[model samples]
Every structure is written in structure tokens, then in C-alpha cells.
Target: MPQTLFDKLWAPHVVADLGDDWALLHVDRVLLHDMSGARALTEVGERGYSLARPDLVFATPDHAVSSAPGRSSATFAGGARPIERLRQRVRETGIRLFDLGQPGHGIVHVMAPELAIVLPGTTLVCGDSHTCTNGGVGALAFGIGASELTHVLATQTLMQRRPRTMRLTFTGTLPPGVTAKDMILAAIGQLGTAGGTGFAVEYAGEAVRALPLEARLTLCNLSIEMGAKMGFCAPDDVTFAYLKGRRFAPTGAAWDAAVAAWRTLRSDDGAVFDREVAIDAGTIAPQITWGTSPEQVAPVTANVPYPAGPADQAALDYIGLAAGQALIGTPVDWVFIGSCTNSRLSDLRDAAAVLRGRKVAPHVTAWVVPGSETVKREAEAEGLHAQFLEAGFEWREPGCALCVCVNGESVPAGKRSVSTSNRNFVGRQGTGARTHLASPAMAAAAALAGAIVDVRSY
Candidate 1:
């Protein structure tokens, strides 16, 4: 009778068992963005289907909006149509949209948590893969395809196969300069990208519990890179503290009641998982992706690995790195610090600590884009933005800048960039661009050194 955290969150939302390990699960929260939300909404409207719960759906314009200062929806010509269409569709559907320049507007994943639109024990779905980022607060969140987005919009429910449960427990103490980004990166390198296929992973153990809520979100944001659609950490005091007094979170007596119920959102002691993996926190160092895949990673002190096969060789060729080459001292042309993966206020603080009195190298173009307007305002309030600008980093407006490269921001072709974004896939930042994934601090260090260097040394 024991239930895992995923089971506890999932069972209550089951509207029906659709058989074949699939179920019709009620969706408590739905997020939409300009890139796909407009199309999905248009589809539903054309079909004459009404939204089952328009109030539960929140839309934003992160994907197609420019992050440049004084930017407007029209700033990115390629994305202007989708932004306009999303604005029009949301008006027709009566869905609440956090429009550009609005207080609540931001990247769907970032603003959702910042505004407390996602909460413990809820089921959230977004059109983007990093929707799993909301799971840090204990939500059963996942991404949906175009059809699935329309289905959820029409019925406020989705048909999904049950995923096996896996627990990744981080034991021991995190080494100096190690971070949640490093922790997850090390796990992916150890287990490979396909390690968590068909499973919903729950992060636990000492190190995971000790992570700040924002860091926990960063940890969960990369779950998709490991082939898992869903990942989460159980609700604890840390989770509760993070949600208190937020815009969408409960208030007064309702807040007290919500906390009481949320306390039971953990897995039962006797609960069984399909698989469990233990990672030593002490063994993990600052991690950087060496190749196209998130799994192609090594510690900052490590060298480019010898190719194990053609796949490895091909990755090396694409990244323009030779086997046995040292990752340290590799020339970096650009440094970007932002993304749903690591763009919260705390992430900015981490990078600022490294760039406080240092200037960026003359040849390295560096940028620091906050994840949301709220984060941008808060960082500015604390003077973090000034420090970055003083250190030769561009203080960019928020919206996935340089991460997806769809909003008029990208590393130029053939440039090498040290980025804090989640994935380092070929051309992820721009055509023929090579991306090295690292923590915000690591990216800052690269910006200062004009090359990949160990953050601990910086």
C-alpha cells in the first residue's frame, strides 16, 4: 500500500484508467508560450472546442520575444507573428496571458514558479520540454506535444502512460565549487543520456535536500536531457518557505491549511521504486559538457575523452575537439548565463560572486540574461546587474536569450561559447556554434579568462 511521491501526486488526479498503462489524468495547471501556444489555441478554436478550465491555463511570450533592452514583440521579426497570434488567441479564449512587459510575463518555466502558479501536489503541463522545472516544488509536471496541448486545453486532462519510478539519491557533501548544475551533469555523464528512460525520477538524499529551492529547480530542469519527462523532489520545509506569500500561493488560514496537506506529499518509507541510483556528492566536481550531448561531460580538471566509438568520434568532430585534449585552457569566444535551467536570482548571484572585481577578457563576449522580469528587477534591486555591467557583461532583459537562439540572440557561427543553459546540442546556440554547458559560475570564469578554466581556481 506504500506509495512513492509520484504515485501520491498522480493517483488523486486520475479521472479514468485508459488501460495499457495509460490514464486520463486531470491537469491542474497548463502553461502556454508564443512558439506553440498560438498554434494550439488556434487549433482548438478552429475545432470549436471550448477550454474545460480557462482559468487554470496561463500563457506567456518567452520563446518568441526578444531579450534586448527596450525590446518589443516586434523586435524579433521572425517571432513577431507568433507573438501577435498568441496575443490574439488568448484574447479569444479568455485565457490569462502574462503578456510582454507585464509584471508576470517571463519564460513559462521561470515565471510559473516565481508567481507560484505551480504548487505542491498539482499536475502541470507546458508545451516546452523544461516544464519539468516546476517539479522542484513537488508538482507532477511534464511537457506535452502539440496534440497533447490541444487535448489538455479542451478537456483539462491528458492521456499518458504511467512511467516507472526512479530515485536518484545524492549522498555525502558537495565539493567546493560544486553545484546543483554540476550534480545533475555528473549524474548524466555517469548514467548516460538514456539512463532514466521510461521513468519519473525523484531526487533525494542529503545533498538534494540541502539544495536551495531555486537550485532544486535547476536540478530538475535537466531531467529531460536524461530522457525523463518528469522529475521532482518531495515537499519539505524548504519548499514551503519558498512558496509562502507568492502571488498565486495561498494566503492566511488557507496558507496554513495548504501547508498541513502538503506535508503528506512525500513517499512512504516502505515505498518501492523500479530503480534507484546513488551519486556521491563529494565526488562530483564542477562539470562541463565536452560534446554535443549532455551525457558527454567531464570534470573541469579532466581532458577531452578518447573516443570509445564512432558516436564519440562524431561528437568530437562536431565540437571541434581532439581526443586527449585538455578541456582547461580551451579558448572560449562567448559566455552566456541564462536559461530555465539556471537563470534564477540565485544563479545570477553565483556568477556575480565570480565577476565582482574582474573584467571579461577582451576577446570574450559575455551576457547575463535573467530568467524573468521579476528576477531582473530583484537582481537590479540588489545591484547584481551593476556588478555584471561593470565586469564587461551585457545586462540583458529576460526571455531565453542565447539559450534557444530563436529571439534574435545567438552565438555567431563557429564560435565557442561557455553557457549556463541546459543542453549543448550542436547549433543549439546558433548555426555551427559550439556550446559548452556549465554552471553560471563556470561560465563567468570562462568570460574572465577567455577560456575554459576551473572555477575553483578563479
Candidate 2:
């Protein structure tokens, strides 16, 4: 029988059929973060349950830890309690907790892939919506609620209904300054936020395959914003090359065997999908979200669109923008270049390239937080941090930072920001903060210009 990539990844993980498309699916990897890990671990202990597969569980403190340079767990007063509790529970349960300043410490989604903990053709779940970010490695990954986290800890399986399949193929080459961020944002703009509801999307075609592994992660990170729980790219040579020497990845003969098996993880010819969408990569430009939702986006050269309904009007009102106003030259007060979505080494390099021989505008406060401690070290080794610091951007430690807005970093109320993070929803960065989502290069350009500007022009 012909099967899609999702079908191949889903079938082998099914432990039992639970009727009506629901099944007991064995989970291959479990990631826990500071925001919810402590509570979930406490609940499991309260219920007198032991971790079914402690070896498969990895915990990290990212959401609640400060990203401030030289920050400790106590640096963020609001996060101190959660960080301490997470440390305690992990100690008791023997789950590996990548503590603050640790080499593997980072946003859960970022470090997991960086460490090769979430591999191709595995099932992973984290207590984070952006857990879908791991799907870049072709894993069947998704976010789970609090209860589901507890359940997964007590038993290495989850009760889940199989999602229908959707294939989004991006044909043609991307134009200069267009990126994976723009590609995904363009898809969401064309398909709307709810277009992928109830479907697991597979991103394929020339453009997707051309993206580097880190770029693919950025592409899949926004899957949740498009109303999909899971999105993935089939593993190919690019995937294999990226994983070949990473820690936790198979080594020696095992690696050869793993690659041999991974090669067969793609969709079989003639396989059918529940839905299919094709996008021309050449048509996508550097995109920025004009309103609250990811779908409320336009090319950087475009203007704020006229409202089609009350919802559109409300978004514009919240963002403090008028219909038909040009996005370019709009004043920006903050620029953030970090998040699980876009804080990798490559993202830093991209931003640094734009800031080289330039300076951030005096009115713009810019920050560059690496995705992980490893990324931080690598970037510094390459003098990327020097470029950003010389250009007037704060070079901070690795963590969620302003993307989650609870880690002692935030854009002030009513201020406009150009951010590389996934979402631009109201209050996502802080109460009443207005965020325009873009790529790292675009965010850097905004910081230099003190407003939104075309990266291409820079």
C-alpha cells in the first residue's frame, strides 16, 4: 500500500487501535521545559507514578530563565520559583535537566534538535506549541497539554487521533532576500490561519529541500500558527548530513543502518493526500505580519491592507496601524533576533551580515539572543557576537527571551517591535506591545533603519 510520509511515521508508532482513528501511540522522545515541567512532574509524583521511560525524557529551563548575559536562575525573579522546582523534580526523577549555563540548555525545541535528541522518523511531544518545530527533522512531533504531559511521563504512550494529511509543495527557486520565514509566512497568508486545521502538513518540493536544516526548522516552527499541530519535511541527504555527527545521533555502523532506514521514510510514489497546496517560491517576498495573526501578512514592499471585516479592523487598531499605510518606514522601537523559531547560529549570522559596518538606530533597542548555549559559543567563536555588539545590539545568553515575554525581557507597552519570533499576537511580547514578525535579516534591517525596511535594500 502506498503511504505518505506522515503515514509511514505514524503507523510504526501505533501501539494499539483505540477506535475511531484514535490509537495508543508510543512516544519516542519527551521534552519538558521550565514553564510546565515542574507542575507536570509534581502531578506524576502526587499520583504515585514513576517515569515509564526516564531515558527518553529530557528537561530544560528556558521559558522561565533570564536570557540576560551572565544571568542565573535567580536573575529573573518571576522565574526563580519555577526554575528551582524544575531542578528539584528532575533531581528526584532522574530525568536529565539541562540546567542554566549548561551546554545543552536552551529552548526545549532548539536544544532537542541541536543535540540530535529528536531524530528522523520518531515520535516526540513537548509541553510547547512550537514542539512542532522538531518536525524539521521529519519527526512526528506535536505539543501536548498539561494532562498529556503527565500521561506521557507515566507511560511512554499517548492517546491520539490520526490527523489527515496535507502536502504543501513550494516549487521554483526563492528570490534574493526571500527566505524560509517568508515562504511559510506567505503560505499562511494565502491559506489563512485555519487552512491546515486537523491536518498534518508535509512541506516538500525544490524550495523546501533547498533550505538548510536550521532553515527547515524555522519553516516548521510556524506550523502551529497556521493551525496545524504537526508539519515536517521528509529526510534526505541534507537531513542526513546535518545529523551525521551530532551528539545522540547514531554513530559508526549504526549511522549507516539508520540512514539506510531513513531513506525509506519518504512518501511512496502515487500516495494520496487529503489535501494538497502548491506555492510558487518566486512569488514570496520578505514578509511581515501587519496585524495580530500570522495570516495578516504582506510583502515588505506592501502596505497595511484595508480591513475586510471587524476582525481585520480590530487587528489594525491593536497594532496602531491604518489601512493602506505603508509598512516600510514605519517606526520601530525594538528589534528582537531570538526565539526557538529563529535564534540558531545561521539566524545570528544572517542578522550579523546585515548589521556589519552599520549601526542600530539610536531610537531602536536591539537584542540578539542565541537559541542555545552551543549556538552562543559558536557565534562568538566566529565573531558574530562582535558584529552585533559593535552594531549596538545586546548580545545575550540563550533562552526563549522576549518571544514568550516572561523571562525578564519584553518590549514595553504600546511600543512597536520587529521580531524574528513566530507569533505577533497582542501581548505576546508584553501587555499592549505591538509586534511585527519577520526574518532575522529583516529584523536587523529594521533595527538599523529604526523602522521597518526592505532587507533587500540593505
Candidate 3:
């Protein structure tokens, strides 16, 4: 039987068919963060169950940690509780933890791939919803809830229903400034937020193949926004090269075996997917989210759509946009260029490139947070920080800064901002703050113009 890339990776993980479309899937890696993971671990201890495989689990403090340089657990107001709790849980389970100030410590999604902790043709699970970000490395990664986390903790396996496979092939070449962020946002705009429900998406075709490893990560990071259970790109030389020298990657003869195995992990030529969509890369432009939902997107040059229903009207109201209003020249009070979705070194470099020799508008408060300490170090080494600092953007330490309101970093209420984070739901950045989602370059353009402007204009 011919099989899709998804089938090639997933079928091997199924331990047993439990009927009703469910299967017992063996999970290769389990990642945990401070906020939800601490609680899940506590529940497992309370239930008197031993961890089935503590060596396979990894822990980090990301979500609730302060991204402020010189920050301690105590430096972030009200952050000590979760950090201490995570440390305690990690100690109890005897699992490895990437603690604050350590080189390996970072946003779970970012660290996993950079360290080669997430390998191709494996299953990875995390308590965070954006766990799908790890799927960028060609793993069958997905997010699980608290109860599900407890189950995985106790047994290193999960019960999940098989998902239909969807293939989205991007043809032609992408124009400069039309990034992976733009590509995913454009797909969501055309397909709506719920379009990929009940499906795992396999991104393919010329454009996808041509993407750098980091950009491929950006594409898969937003798969959740399109309602995908997970998303992945088939492994090839680019994938192997990125993983080759990483700490956790297999070495020597083991490396040869791993690469040989990965080469066969792609879909057979005659394989068929349950659903298929094709996108012309040339047609995609720099995208901006107009309403709260990621699907409510428009090209930077386009006007906001006129509301077609009460739901649309409500989204417009919450986001402070009027029907048919233009997004260009719309005033912005803040600009954030960071998140697990787009906070890697390449993302920072792209934003810094736009800010070089240009000052941010006096009224806009702009920030650039690195995704990991390693990325921060690399960017600073390459003088990327100086460009941002000279352009009036704050260069912060790594963590999920300003992406969610949990760490007390927030955009003030009634303010409008351009951000590169994944979600723009109401109150995602802070209470009552209106978020306009865009690529890092687009965010940089907005920071300079003090209003939404096309990056192509810069």
C-alpha cells in the first residue's frame, strides 16, 4: 500500500488499535514547562504512580519566566511560585531540566529542535498548545491537556485517534519579504481557522522545499492556528544538516544509520492524501491579521473587510477596527517581535535588517525578544542587537515575552500593536490591548512608521 509521509512516520508509532479510530501511540519525547507541567507532575505523585520513563522527559521554565535581562525567579513579580514548583517537580521525578541561566534553557519548542532533542520520525508531546512547533523537525508532535499530561507522564504513551492527512503544496517562488509567516497566514486567511480540523498537514512542493530550516519551523509553528493537529515537512539533506552537529543528534555510525532511515521517511510517489490544497507562492504578500482570529487576515496593502455578520462585527469591535477601514497607516502604539512562533535567530535577523539605519517612530514602544539564550548570544555576536538598539527597539532575554500576559509583560489596555506572535485572540498580549499580527519585517515596518505599513515599502 502506498503511504503519505504522515503514514510513514505515524504508523510505526501505533502500538495497538483500540477500535473507534483510537490507537495506543508510543511517545518518544515529553516536554514540560513551568506553568502546566508542575501541576501535572504533582497530580501524578499524588496518585502514587511512578514515572514510566523519566529519562525520556524534559523540563524547562519558559512560559512564566521573566524575559528581562538580569532576571531571577524573584525578578519577575509573582513568578517565583511557578519556577520553584517546576524545580521541585523536576527533582521529584529525577528528570533532566533546562534551568534558567543555563545554555540549554529556552522556550521548550525552540530548545527541542535546536538541541536535536526532537528527531525525525518520532512522536513528541508537550503540555503547551504550540507543541506542534516541534513538528517542524518532522516529528509527530502535538499538545496535550492536563489530564492527558498525567497519563503520558505515568505511561510514556497516549491514546489518540488517527487523523486524516492533508497535503498543501506551494508552487513557484516566494517574493522577497513574503516569508513563511506570510505563507501560513495567507493559508489560514483562505481556509479560515478551522479548515484543518481532524487532519495532520504535510507541507510540500518547491517553495516548502526551498525554505531554510528556521523558516520551516515558522511554518509548522502556526499549524495549530489553522486547526491542524500537527504539521511537518519531510526530512531531507537540509534537515539532516541542521541536526548534524547538535548535542542530542546521533553521531558517527549512528548518524549514518539515522540519516539512512530518514531518507526513506518521505511519502511514496503514488501516495494519496485525504485532502489536498495547492498555493501559488507568488500570490502571497506580507500578511496582517485584521480581526482577532488569525483567519481574519489581509494583505498589507488591502483594507479591512467589511463585517458580514454579528460575529464579524464583534471581532471588529474587539480589535478596534471599523468595517472596510484601511490597515495601512493605522496608528500603532507597540511593536513586539518575538514568540515561540517567530523568535528564532533568523526572525531577529530579518527584523534587524529592516531596522538598520532607520529609527523607530517616537511614539511606538518596540521590543525584540530572542527565543533562546543561544539565539540571543548568536545575534549579539553578529551585531544584530546593535541595529535594533540603534533603531529604538529593546533587546530582551529569551522566553515567551509579550506573547502571553502570564509573565506580567504586556501591552497597555486601549493600545494597538503590531506583533509577530502566533495568536491574536482578545487579551492575548494583555487586557483590552488590540493586537495586529504580522511577520517580523512587517512588525519592524510598523514600528518605524508608527502605523501599519507594507514592508515592501521599506
lDDT of 2 by residue, 121-188 (tens): 99999999999999999999999999999999999999999999999999999998888999999999
State the C-alpha lDDT per candidate: 0.93, 0.94, 0.91
lDDT of 2 at 41: 93
State the local distance difference test value for candidate 1.
Answer: 0.93
Candidate 1 versus truth, CA RMSD in Å, comes to 0.8
Models 1 onward score TM values of 0.99, 0.99, 0.98
The CA lDDT at 213 in model 2 is 97
Ranking by TM-score: 2, 1, 3
Question: Candidate 1: where is the Cα deviation over 4 Å?
Answer: none
Per-residue lDDT tens digits of candidate 3, residues 205-241?
A: 8999999998999999999999996999998899999
Instruction: Report the CA-based lDDT of candidate 3 relative to the real structure.
Output: 0.91
Q: What are the clashing pairs of model 3? A: none
Clashes of 2: 0
How do all the candidates rank in terms of lDDT, highest first?
A: 2, 1, 3
